[model samples]
Target: MVNFLQRFLVFLNIYSIFADGYSFNNDEHTENIHPFIKIGSKYYFINELLKMNWFESYNYCRSYGGELASVESHEELLALQNYILARKIESRFWFDGNDLAEEGKFVSHTTGRPLIFNKWSQNNPNNVNNEDCLEVNLYNKELLMNDINCNVENIAICKYREPNTHCSGKNSLMNQNEVCILRNLVESFAQVGHRCKSCSQAFMFPTS
Candidate 1:
């Protein structure tokens, strides 16, 4: 009976969250939930500790409601590069660019489109030893892109996709608070066979 009640509460909590027409598709909803830093119009989460291969990095970002960072313009690229330099981080980080579909034709894994902007280092994309993954190197005050082997581990940088603006208007705070309460309720029942892992991940609720 206790288990059934917990499951029912979880369902009700999830239902309440959606009943108001709000969903996790909104990046604003996660602003206070995750450790994303806002830069320009997008939010980014840079993992300086955990290193993963290109494919692993791609999925890691998606698991956090984002995708591997993609450079769509020179200004955006400069902003990101500047951020790295400002932080004095010296690690190569993975981006969404790759030439897996076609050699010498780098495209964004996020959008499946040709990279709109690239600041390649001297003679980059050389495909040296089957290099197909893209990474940004910050060395000697220079930020440049390079293609490397997909299996090479690198820091994962993720950019949150543009969010739905439905919750940007009046009463936004009230709505957000309600969603938070619902998410908490669902998480509270998670250990009771409620299985709110998907919902918790969507909202980035702390697992502990």
Candidate 2:
């Protein structure tokens, strides 16, 4: 596992350099460095302080081989919030948490997992004005989550497998957690598709 993590770190750094280059970020402030950051096992892609509607943000993340950022837990939420605040960004931003999948049920579009943790402010998520999207209220000291119109433009925060990463998105029945972890690990491999078959097997049945 240590060996694998070390390899993953190296690959992530190289990928970061590639993404920071002009050809890759032609329109989104090509000069800005640190396009993304890896925290724990997830890779987060932050825009050049640009604001876009939730739908646009989601699609943009997908185009780059990822999905909208998922603040699955309070710790994760606070960590990201601090990271943004540290940059002196006072703007509230978008993260994956919406009831679009099912009315009154907010789940991550990327993983289809129910929202388990939240920091919603008072009277937030009131679904006012037919709002169905989620955003982090940066100005709120408590880091409240709020429901807003999907079309409302806001800073886009995305996370998932990095761009240029390849995968089959296929895996046998196995530990869901491991699958998620491995999915991100092999994301950068062009041959990860067919390779996942064997790779998944190896994890299920280890050698030695």
Candidate 3:
């Protein structure tokens, strides 16, 4: 049972969604409920974000927080979808889990390869030989169950890696922060040069 305010907000959001060309079949849950929290400008999932297989959803969430869903079961998946739909959100979303690398190597967007629990569709992952990545189609909000080429131009999921984890030695030396500090010191010295008196030495000023 949605409260009056939550229902109202959901209505407003649905209106905006439709105005933006989103066309979704309204599910029974057409209320605005979010399983995530927004702080400052980023959104973090209240529970672990679902790890589905869609570049678009991944990118969308990344713009706000981290990867897509890491849902453990079909029940959880439906629950999430219902949660989003109730919130009046349209369009299919991406999950942050995939096995694009090795066969049976499903990995979480936040974690890495070799997931502890693996979920796959019936006869899924029939990669058909060339696929190496996965993407969830908007029309059908389900896992691709196969691999795709990473180079394909499409929405992408992004996650924040541990800060300074991937940076190398050269990268550290080229720190932009150090450069900025150095630049400020040089500018300060130049600005104060006009206030300094000439040296008392007779040769202070070059003859030239």
Worst 10-residue lDDT window, candidate 1: 164-173
The lDDT leader among the candidates is 1
Please give the TM-score that candidate 3 achieves against the real structure.
0.36
Candidate 3 per-residue lDDT over residues 118-201, each given as its tens digit? 345557556655545554332255433334544444443233321242333345322323334344444554554443345332
Report how far off residue 6 is in candidate 3 (Å): 48
Best by TM-score: 1
**Ranking of all predicted structures according to lDDT, beginning with the best and ending with the worst:** 1, 2, 3
**Local accuracy of candidate 2 as per-residue lDDT tens digits, 1-208:** 4444556678767755654553444434323325556654455888756799998998888787677887667778777867777777777788788998677788877667887787777877788898899898765555678889999999888886433323344642222233353455566453544555565545733555
Model 1 segments beyond 4 Å from truth?
1-33, 164-208
Supply candidate 1's per-residue lDDT for 67.
Answer: 90
Q: How well does model 1 score by local distance difference test? A: 0.78
What is the C-alpha local distance difference test score of candidate 2? 0.69
Model 3 error, position 139 (Å):
9.9
lDDT of model 2 at position 11: 78
Tell me the spans in candidate 3 whose CA falls farther than 4 Å from its real position: 1-60, 83-93, 116-119, 136-208
